[model samples]
Target: MSTLEQTPIGAPGGAAPAGVIHDIGYQRYTGPRLSRRHVVGALYGHSLRTAFGLGRSAKAKIFPWFIVGVVVVVAAALVAIRAQIGQVVLGYAQFADTMSWLVIFFVAVVAPELVSRDLGSGVLPLYFSRPLRIADYPLAKFAALATAVFLLLGAPQVVMFLGGAFTTDAGWSGVWNEFTDLLPGLGYALLWAVVFGGIGLVVAAITGKRAFAAGGIVAVFLMTTPIVGVLSVLPSTTANQLAGLAAPSSLVQGTGIWLFRDALVTNQEGGMGIGDFGPVYALVTVGLIAGCTAVLLARYRKAARQ
Candidate 1:
């Protein structure tokens, strides 16, 4: 009665072969195909999660989450201090300036994991086989990294805002003043995210080896600052001020000061004061971000073409 049957083969003196190709009612996919936009969105979400060490092994998550935990604890402590002192010990505008190194470290560690891993593992071809375009890959990756960095930098500022608002004694007016101050702080944080995220991703994109990429990112951030610091002390004030532009961190801090129209506070670490360098720092910051992005996109385009 059955039209299908199994066949067995074996050597004359050996046991019969045992295997079956079953007709278990497998079917071809008949669902609507997802468009390239959907694919890019999915990739973006996935890469964003990866940046924060979400959906990964505990070992993989320790660095990013530990950095996050440290920031949260520091913010909580600052809030408590502010409440007790009845004065702002750490203003939101200075938060990024204070924590810039940790942010740099985070970008160094995570950016390589996102882009370098894909390249090093020889998986780009597989990614290319999907509905995703070449440009879409880097754009999505950059967006994800930038978003992760933004959250890392922005969350503490939010905490600071709440802390400042609640501790103010002048009721709603105090809260309003604090809110006004917070807006510029948040804007500065976003600039840090974009600039740092762009540089980190571009460095990572240059190499497939995660170790090398991470090292390159760190060296670029760490080495340039000291070099600029040395140069800033030169006898020539113009040379000293111009030297500030050499360091990415300084550029970011200078841009923040310029954009926020805020005075250079003692706690702020990088760059010459806004008075010293003015809008050149901001222009250079924009240039650095734009240049890195162009290089990243161009690298991906070449990879996609090949």
Candidate 2:
């Protein structure tokens, strides 16, 4: 019947009773805060895991691991064949050409999952609210993706090298020679990682929808190939050679040929004479990667400002 008792539920025209405050111990974080570098590193590691669908659901993992399994199996088969028949069935450098489509599919699937999910979920503000800078986000994401692509491309080559080493009847010298050959292919894979990863991230960042982003990335890569093909058949060899610049795959293959000093039969057989372009393709490849990276940075910068 006192004042406290008078504050009953649905007490008409009565002021609300004062709320009770419980003293549960809640401590402020006085621990050493991580710097921007650590934040970027953490993000990079996470994005790399995300690329292969690690730490994600089974459905998410199937695509990447499936591609990886296929590559491994093929590399193993090549090695077995070499051991049996005593000849190289697939060269380290040729692996890139053979697996180009799988690489494209991978970048398309992963790039969207990296950037578009962040944008679509409205998490950029949360990311920006941390010690992370605008540029750091893209840098980390690109690094993660590039690293992922490199592993995707490089792991098979390593397997191929080992396969070649053990299978070669020439012994230690053969192993050394195989190692030397892999070096250039490794370099070529690095180029693929950079160029493909950069462009995929840029395209994916443009759309919040993962499907749309994936589709756009695929379309851009696949569409350019046909255009290059058509142009390759032109009467003028110069025009045909120049057309290789239009497609990223051609450009990378062209650069690989120049760097490895080995003619890529795919480029030659496909009528896209990218090797003829020489260092021009390498220069263009670097330019394209640089340009895409610039655009990706600018896009994230704008998002951060907003």
Candidate 3:
């Protein structure tokens, strides 16, 4: 046979050889691959959508209103105190101080809703069935809320610093001075947010009722702080500064500001150095935050495995 005639039948152009072709039926799937960016984007997009929807609705809008109200009240209070006392009020010194409260509020109130709403509406299961992973849920939620909290809490600090700088004796140089003065303050803000945010997430994960989570967060972070503060004064080692359940008191104490004064007037140096019990207090703060993270991860793993 000629070379052309001897070619196999199963070639692309034609089939000449008998029994050369075998049909193996398999459906080809040409869908796009899901990636981390896609997942993160979905999460971020959902968060923005959720926030927007809340704004459009009456009941949901309450949260934002509450935030605004808090800011307004705080601003007014600061002004009044400055006018009356010739110094800023306790707990109303800088934007960072006020923003700390906002972070605490967000954790206590908004966090439960983030997860509980989906769980209540039976949306969580559906999320798990898709390319969405359980781990991403907490991460996304934290990131979204953290970003908002930072903007809500941190941005004001920047503005306040700027305003205080140029409008007063604190120009750019003064701004830098205040910024340096507030480095510890910034760290305290982050420590507070992460610590409480993690607590809120863990509580939401553990409970079926969002109310329970919310209430628990309040009792643990808000009410417990004072209670622990009282206990810490009872002649115990943990009572001195470390006795409190959360980091706020220690942070405040470490910051050397008492009862929310603006002058940084405490006899203590605000523990700016790690050797100055700053490290010890920081380690405690980090430990609490780490615990919350562990709890969140463990809860997510359990849910995912189920």
TM-score of each: 0.88, 0.90, 0.69
Which predicted model would earn the best lDDT? 2
Total clashes in model 2, counting residue pairs 3 or more apart in sequence or in different chains:
0
lDDT of 1 by residue, 1-306 (tens): 223444465445455545546576778999999999999999999999998788999998999999999888888899998888877777787877788899999999999999987776667777888677778889899999989888887898889888888778899999998888888777878888899899999999987689999999999999998888887788977877677688888788767766776533543344464465767887888788889989998998777666
Error of 2 at 111 (Å): 0.8
Cα displacement (Å) at residue 30, model 3: 9.1
Q: Candidate 3, 212: how far from true, in Å?
A: 1.8
Quote the lDDT for 255 in model 2.
78
Q: How accurate is candidate 1 locally (lDDT)?
A: 0.83
Candidate order by TM-score, decreasing, is 2, 1, 3
* Per-candidate total of colliding backbone pairs: 0, 0, 8
Using lDDT as the measure, what is the rank order of every candidate, best first? 2, 1, 3
lDDT of 2 by residue, 1-306 (tens): 122234556666667754544556677999998898899999999999999999999999999999899988988888888888887766777887888889999999999999997887767878987688888899999999999999988998999888888767788998999999899788888888998999899999987699999999999899998888788788987887788788888788777777776635544565546545787987888789889989988998888767
lDDT per residue for candidate 3 within 1-306, as digits (tens), equals 212234454566665553333446656888988886798788876774454235356877677667856765665555455545545343213455435556666666667777777766666666666677777777787666555555555544544444444444545786677576555445544544565566677787778477888777776656656765565556745456555334454454443343223444432344321123555665666676678677776776676655
Worst 10 residues of 2 by lDDT: 1-10
Every candidate's CA RMSD? 4.6, 4.7, 9.2
